[model samples]
Target: MLFRFLVFLYPVIRTLGPATAALLLIAGISLIGYAVLRQPGLWSWLAAGACLLSAGLLALLCHSYHWWLFKLRPHGSLFIPIK
Candidate 1:
């Protein structure tokens, strides 16, 4: 029973956790703008807002990433760097 509950709740918790964290970052930034900057422009606020949203969505997707998604490239010649 306990194991079943855990399994069911894991994905819910994972999705919400990232979303909540993202909101917190956004709120913190807004507070800073209000307190220190006194007042920020609409575009600046929107840019910060976008960053917070993207970060949270990214975090959520990261939890579902497959091991095969992370392929490593071959590394050779430590003395030489090529672009």
Candidate 2:
């Protein structure tokens, strides 16, 4: 679910500059990880949300991805850069 939402939002985010988008994504994931560690019940909530909304949510996610970007080369501006 989280991945789907990220995919659905990434193109719009990339418009703000890919570097900014990537940094914001990294920060957001770090924050979410912290939150989950502080309150483990988040996993149960996530599971419940998944169970309740799986079908329509997945359909919307599939429809939302910007597939055309796949053809654009120089794809080496990696989102998760290697150290």
Candidate 3:
């Protein structure tokens, strides 16, 4: 169930850019680690792990589409050329 949700998030994250994806991945891992050490319930652990996995997949997706993600935007023109 969680895996399916993460799969769906891949394309959304890919459009967000590598830096954002990487930051999210790092934050997710940190949260999972913190939960493992402080949380007592199995559900909490599973939830944290799912978040971490999702972030990791997002990062990978972003990296795979890096070039497309950072494509140059069209520049604005000062004035329209006379036809």
Candidate 4:
């Protein structure tokens, strides 16, 4: 459950930087591999797949929305309003 949540937030965290994102992604993959090896089951695989799919979809949606916003407003401002 927590792992899925982390996967879902993967893209968001990726905005930090490529190196950081790559490291985190590798860690996540390792964790996933460990889970699969520890408990090899059909349901576990299905759940992992589903989590990955949803996370990818979410990342796509976020990227598209960010692109749209950038297109709509070309000002040099970030999508996240930092104070």
Candidate 5:
């Protein structure tokens, strides 16, 4: 019932792709960083962790997704029929 409706909507939402998720995460981190920076006692550790997390997210979003890049030849074989 509800699951079917949500599943139908999944592709339409995913059409916007990973960049949107990365951007949203970056915005959230920015807000958190601002709040943490304002606090006097917990500034250093919170800011460091937030910065590391944001950097990791950015790195993940920007990287190539191709998993078969190491080989010189194309991954497809004649024996393996196309789906």
Candidate 6:
């Protein structure tokens, strides 16, 4: 029963997570554009770029979650998915 539930949930999660990350990235870019129009300052761009970079990094981390789990662990006691 649990296996079936997880099987169903996986696709839902796979679809939702990337969409959420994409929305975050879009919001970051739009904010940067708005900031440029409003203030046109160097420091503002730097800050907005930092925020955008962080969001991109977060999306990357999500995509590489299994790799990170394997890398962070001291011993390989569990099997990490290649997919």
Please tell me which predicted candidate would have the highest TM-score against the true structure.
Answer: 6
Candidate 6 — which pairs collide? none
lDDT of 4 by residue, 1-83 (tens): 54344445546645643444445445556557866789776765666666555556555544564454445543565444222
Q: Give lDDT tens digits, candidate 1, residues 1-83.
A: 54344345556645575776667677757755764476666766676667667666656554643221222213352222122
lDDT of 5 by residue, 1-83 (tens): 44334344445434543656566566657656666677444664566566657656544533422211222224464222122
Off by over 4 Å in 5: 39-83
- Ranking, lDDT, top scorer first: 6, 3, 1, 4, 5, 2
What value of lDDT does candidate 5 attain over all alpha carbons?
A: 0.48
TM-score (C-alpha, index-matched) for candidate 2: 0.28
TM-score of 5: 0.36
Higher-lDDT candidate of 3 and 6: 6
The local distance difference test score of each candidate is 0.53, 0.48, 0.58, 0.53, 0.48, 0.65
Backbone clash pairs in model 1 (N, Cα, C under 3 Å; residues 3+ apart or in different chains), count = 0
Give lDDT for model 3: 0.58
Model 3 agreement with the true structure over 1-83: per-residue lDDT tens digits: 44344345656654665667667667767777777788767876777677777777766656654333233223463322122
Model 6: per-residue Cα lDDT over 33-61, one tens digit each: 87778978787677777767867876776
The deviation in Å at residue 78 for candidate 3 is 33
After TM-score superposition, what is the CA distance of residue 63 in candidate 5 from its true location, in Å?
Answer: 16
Lowest summed lDDT window (length 10), candidate 4: 74-83
> What is the TM-score of each predicted model, taking all chains together?
0.35, 0.28, 0.46, 0.41, 0.36, 0.58
Candidates sorted on TM-score, descending = 6, 3, 4, 5, 1, 2
Off by over 4 Å in 4: 1-31, 66-83
Candidate 2 ranges with C-alpha deviation above 4 Å: 1-16, 39-83
